[model samples]
Target: MTGSLTAARAMAAAAARLRAAGVADPARDARLLLAHAARIDAARVTLIAPEELSPEIAERYEQLVSLRAIRVPVSHLTGEREFYGRRFKISGEVLDPRPETETLIEAALSEPFARVLDLGVGSGCILVTLLAERAQATGLGVDISEAACLQASANAVLHGVAERAEIRRSDWLSDVAGRFDLIVSNPPYIALDEMAGLDEEVRRHEPELALTDGGDGLGAYRRIADGVMRHLAPGGRLLVEIGPTQVAAVIALFAQAGLVDIGIVQDLDGRDRVIRARRG
Candidate 1:
């Protein structure tokens, strides 16, 4: 780390440091951070493994590793996260897009809709991905946090869907108007009691508003359900990402809202991940 260090050696040292600090997948993170420091793609890290690190790149890598050892998420360090085959700019102001949410995306693209509404659009991954996948579609994405709204907007612009996507700050459906053929949300469903059980990266770095509803975790769903019928077109669809243990609770909420065809979709891990329902 002091002088004339090769990329491989530096990464090996960094990985050991991360491992000692309890970072899961230390080697992978080491490789990725090295690539970031060197201004190269992660895949190219191996090509430069034998080459000596520039003083500047070595210094940069040290700073990044230091942050990672403290459990700052890799996506936050890289300033972006890949979701649904696209990368979205991310920050501590918003929740990092997760792979489990792709279950909702698949369910969304399974049907056709010209209009969509994304509630609690943390990073706009759901709405933006849908619009990107369906070029003819236009959408509105709302979040209670202005910072989240800004993050979502940046992602919409990054994916070339800003022209078709509108990002706004609203508490659930309060400021939203007009009926849409589709509505989706990956709202804050974590219960307050469960907050302490989260990983350091999530518990410390991600926005709390984007992670928990400050209650039993059903608060956002309740708000969404109360107003959904008024905003949904008849026979329109509503899709939401949910915790694995939330299937019964969410189904009951949706059913009470008079949504029909309520069903569950599991993620790659076979856990109940999304609930899809249609307006009656």
Candidate 2:
């Protein structure tokens, strides 16, 4: 914690200290948080840390360190996470976007869909990234949590796609109108019974509303399928990220709801992470 080296060197040394403190991915998280405070990338820290460390920068690193010691997510500490090659802001009010969901983004981008819907669009990473990539597309994002809705709205504007995206506070699609060519959701698919078994970093810090659907993991899937059935255009697709274990149940849920061409999509790790189906 004591150092006279440049800010960059100090940050790296501090991150090594964090690794000793039992933080997983300590260097990566520490480097990212420090870079945010120093207004530089983690790689540049090696050169910059040779310069004198300002009291202000030292204080900022102290705060970020304190938060991480308690298992606070790096995204929460840095206020941003990169997904699908874009950065999205995150806070306690919304679920921090996860890298795995980028698979859903990739699936959406594979097709040339013009209209999309993102249910439970926490922080708006999925929708905003898609719309940003396909500048000609228009979309709607719905979230049951008003705070999440606000965060998604902010992300939309941040990505310069607010004009083409409308974010709303709606339970599923209760308040949304019209149909979309594609619908995507990475909802609270964790079952309530499994909450206690998860790592404390997840159960203790992540928003429960974005982590579990209360009754079972499938509640969100049911709601999503119902909405897609009601609002998806012919040949439109619904791509949803599912917990690896829930693939079979979610696939059946989609089939029961009348969706066709049901299939499981794997993630970078080859897990059955997404359930995609086309409305016939």
Candidate 3:
């Protein structure tokens, strides 16, 4: 927070700064930042419309704005992001789940999976959401980042599914034991060379490991295809989120892994964002 907007005048002034700085939703962002600083919801801020915030809260709010001005994502500034229409806790340690990835969750949910595995799980959003939606299912969310595993585990508990969800640090399926009816992942798929062209917020705030596939952006797909069958039960299905342009390449990778009945699913925008295959 730069500081809180203590009064109507202060909020108006802050709004002007945000607008000048090209924040698309300046008023909404300012209100959101202020509400966070005050430890109150935006609805509550409206209730106290005529009042001035305490000095401490004002200062905090300003700091949030200052960070946002530097291109940090609003989700990061707020430490929360909405995925599959549910809120999840997130930080620099994990990838921020996006709406498009929800398509993968929905595809998996279309089947009544008894056991599920989420590789490269970050923030526990996918696995937790799966267990929550399919009450009879148990899940494991595996990630290389221990910090991310901890955060994801916390989210599982928060959503009342910790007992059914195990968040463990593993490089894909390596060092993990599992045979799941379903598997899914929203792994890092951006090529390192393309990172420089990403949006300011993504490049400036999101973790590079979670954004880039290290070099070709196809590395994650290779790793997943190589390891997926090792932990996938025969007849199980795997659903993975892929970049728009990566649909064909990842499909080929899955084929090389002996997966069959392969198919791609598109997002709302009609981009091929998910690849679903059955383990042979």
Candidate 4:
């Protein structure tokens, strides 16, 4: 059915389908899908808008558009997401790296670190980005999901950090050894009750283990803060990404753990997004 449609028309129709499905950014999603369908850059889609799609690409585009109509994440459909100015391969197995997480990355880079550890290292985006930027830094990333560890390993190789980055299957830091100068995490902070109310794309498509702790949202933070004191070298820093409303509770956990110089960093939106602390 799509073979008979011009590129521009195909995009318009796809946008309509997405809009009808209640997608927030139907036009942008449509453009990205069209570019993906044609196997070309999204920026070039406009140049080819007047052209007709080959039968094969057209059918694939139609199928992807249909999937999007059901609220499947675009990154999952495309199999990639850009984070921290680098492309990270993505899947339903790992959290799709978001631009807001870059706030954590920027804060991490603000200080010099020769070694790093990433807890709950889904897709290895945080670890790999740090290794790539610091060049001399070697890091370890651990995740509870073996599938996530595998995906993160692949991403490490993809980004040319395989030699410096190690991926492991572990619950938080249970299998981790030795202390490090920097430790970072983007642990699940969504309470069990909040999971059901998330957007369909997140609730249905993202892994539940990475989105919630099956109890209060603060469980992961408590665990992280408790276990971190022993693993953090004296003067080492720990940075964690938190839900917008979790700033106070998370800071309290850090204080109870005897961490000092604790502070919060806000995302560009001005909501508290990262909590930073130093081991005494």
Q: By lDDT, who's the top model here?
A: 1
What global local distance difference test value does model 1 have? Answer: 0.93
Cand. 3 TM to true fold: 0.92
| Candidate 1 lDDT tens digits, 1-280 | 8449999999999999999999999999999999988999999999999999999999999999999999999999999888988989999898899999999999999989999999999888889999999999999999989999999999999999999999998989999999999999999999999999998779999899988999999998999899999989998999999976788999999999899999999899999899999998
lDDT, each prediction: 0.93, 0.86, 0.85, 0.92
Q: List the residue pairs that clash in candidate 1.
A: none
TM-score of 4: 0.97
Better of 1 and 3 by lDDT: 1
Q: Cα miss at 246, model 4 (Å)?
A: 1.5
What C-alpha lDDT does candidate 4 achieve relative to the native structure?
0.92
lDDT of 1 at 40: 97
Q: Identify the runs in model 3 with alpha carbons over 4 angstroms from their true place.
A: 1-12
**CA deviation > 4 Å runs, candidate 1:** none
Q: Please count the clashing residue pairs in each candidate, in the order shown.
A: 0, 6, 13, 0
Candidate 4: list runs displaced more than 4 Å.
none
Please give, for residues 1-280, the per-residue lDDT of candidate 3 as tens digits.
2224345655666677788888888887877777777788766877665677777877877788888776677788898887886889989988888888888888998878999998888899999999999999998888988889898988998899999998888888787796899998898999988988998777877888888878989998898888888888989999988887898899899999999999989889999889999988
Each prediction's RMSD over C-alphas, in Å, is 0.9, 1.5, 2.2, 1.0
TM-score of each: 0.98, 0.95, 0.92, 0.97
